[model samples]
Target: MLGISFFSVVSFLLVWELACRNGVVDPIFLPAPSQVLERAVRMFTEGTLLWHALASTRRVMVGFLVATMAAIPLGILMGTSQRTRAAFDPILSFLRPLPSMSWIPLSLLWFGITETQKYSIVFMGTFAPALLYVIDATRSIDPLLIRAARNLGANRWQVMREVIMPGSLPQIISGFKVILGLSWTCVISAELVAAKEGLGFLIMNGKEFFQTDTVVLGMVMISLTVLLTDIVSRVIEKRILKWQA
Candidate 1:
């Protein structure tokens, strides 16, 4: 599978490079793979590429971690308690439909163009969905299992620790992988406004200068970063869910 994927990507790049060299496509519009690579090399040598990538990565991780940490416990509570879920349902409904871009104005007003504003955008964007995912994961646990745990003389806390948590964890991790990707989009939206450095800023700056290669390089970097994070998530998932193996 890896070899096939590599061959497919190489073939696509070869075709793209040839199309640009043969004048089949305008370089100004869609840059060749080599052009994007050259731009990446230049930016890396100048120390800007890593800086922007790290900036965006930091914002994404900070916001994503904070949001998930808050969501998981609350979601579990809401999932276990009907009254809590009912109380929060209206708020979730309002929040779940809001796009990350919509939070930019309010976050800027609330946080005043600081890093906090960027993190807030990502937080607001991801929190609702992450909560929903966790809620569903928790509710998916079998009631029979809970009853059995209780029948075995387990207390509520023990039942939660040994039964609910393990039952819900796999789905929570899977959902969080998706939320992590969503957090990247939120960070991009946040950076599009007040950020001085990030992949989003790089893309916008490159666009203003008509530097298509730089723009493409920024986009490529975002994809690569997301891919790297997803791999990291998979590694963590494997270690934590070794029972699944």
Candidate 2:
């Protein structure tokens, strides 16, 4: 696996460098791999690259955590109670179709071009769908398990906490993994308006200056960061869901 990964990356970089060097692709439109790497190195030495990457990462984490924290409980409640489900269904339906970009206007109005506005955009974009995923996961728990828990003298709250929550946690975590990726996409939209530093901002700024290298670097950074985060999430999931795995 390590060998394959190394070779694949090496081959890609080689082909990319060759393509630009040989004029198969225009450097102005798509900067050479070396140019992008040089920009990355310069940015790193200057510290702006790290700052932009961290800013975007922080936004994604904060928004994703807040959205997950809010969604799980509400979703569990909706799944467990018919009344709650009925009350929330229409609202969820309304919000679910709204894209992240749609929330930017209202978020900016509410938070006024602050970091909070960016976080709000991501939260609003992710929350509805995340809640629905949790609800579905909760509902999919076997009714027989609930019945057994009740028969064993578990109260409603006890059953929810001990039986339902535990039963649904694996799926909930999996859903959050998907939501985390979505949050990154939302971060881009969030930065589109007024962000001064973030991978998204870097990309936008690069475009205005016709610096394709910076734009490419921004995109590559996003993908690499997402991959790293995915690895962390998977490790956490494995540890948390040890019993199931």
Number of the predicted model whose TM-score against the real structure is largest: 1
lDDT of each: 0.95, 0.93
Query: Compared with the true structure, what per-residue lDDT tens digits does model 1 show for residues 1-245?
Result: 99999999999999999999999999999999998998899899999999999999999999999999999999999999999999999999999999999988888788898999998999999999999999999999999999999999999899989999999999999999999999999999888778889999999989989999999999999999999999999999999999987
Winning candidate number (lDDT): 1
Position 151, candidate 1: lDDT: 99
Q: How do the predictions measure up, each by TM-score?
A: 0.97, 0.97
Candidate 2 residue pairs that clash: none
TM-score of 2: 0.97
Q: Over the stretch 1-245, how does candidate 2's per-residue lDDT look in tens digits?
A: 99999999999999999999999999999998999999999999999999999999999999989999999899999999999999999999999999999988888778897999988989998999899899999999999999999999999999988999999999999888999999999999889677988999999999999999999999999999999999999999999999985
Residue 84 Cα positional deviation in candidate 2, in Å, after optimal superposition:
0.3
Clashing pairs in 1: none
